[model samples]
Target: MNTFHPQYLNDSQGNTISVVIPLAEYEQIVKQLDELEGIRLHVNTHTGKRPSIPLDEFVRQRMAFSKPIPPAHNGEPIGSPLL
Candidate 1:
């Protein structure tokens, strides 16, 4: 077994768990990891953070806060000479 050679292993959930290989495998593993990173970077570059509030949801929230309630009547307008 090459001291630096390696082999990939997976867990029960199909996730990469460990790598066991000689030094020769280092380059390949590094390349794969780099490719994965590149893909991630590319995706992030293309797609930025998604808007948390959609247009309709934003309008609804704005309206809820901006609506005015009718003034309470005290039986008559103040200073109108009538109660």
Candidate 2:
């Protein structure tokens, strides 16, 4: 449970119309809400147990997809192999 010193605005009929909270409290609430949303997204996106990848296959796929490039600090051209 949480407690706060809430301030309220009333309409002409003395009905509660709006409420105000401290800026720090408001920021804390926003941060909590963002965290809750992230948790909900994670729950919704995962359907089953994660698939496992073998180390040998992972290394082979990685090597096939990647290429070695010259370092940028040497002012070498990109994509083309250095002589």
**Candidate maximizing TM-score:** 2
Q: Give a tens-digit lDDT track for model 1, residues 17-56.
A: 9977765577767887899988887787689834366877
TM-score of each: 0.34, 0.53
Score residue 5 of candidate 2 by CA lDDT: 71
Which segments of candidate 1 are over 4 A away from where they belong? 1-20, 49-83
Candidate 1 CA-lDDT value: 0.66
Number of backbone-clashing residue pairs for each candidate, in the order shown: 9, 0
- Kindly list the per-residue Cα lDDT of model 2 for residues 1-83, writing each as its tens digit: 55677899999999999999998888888988999988776766696544457978777777777778757877875764321
Candidate with best lDDT: 2
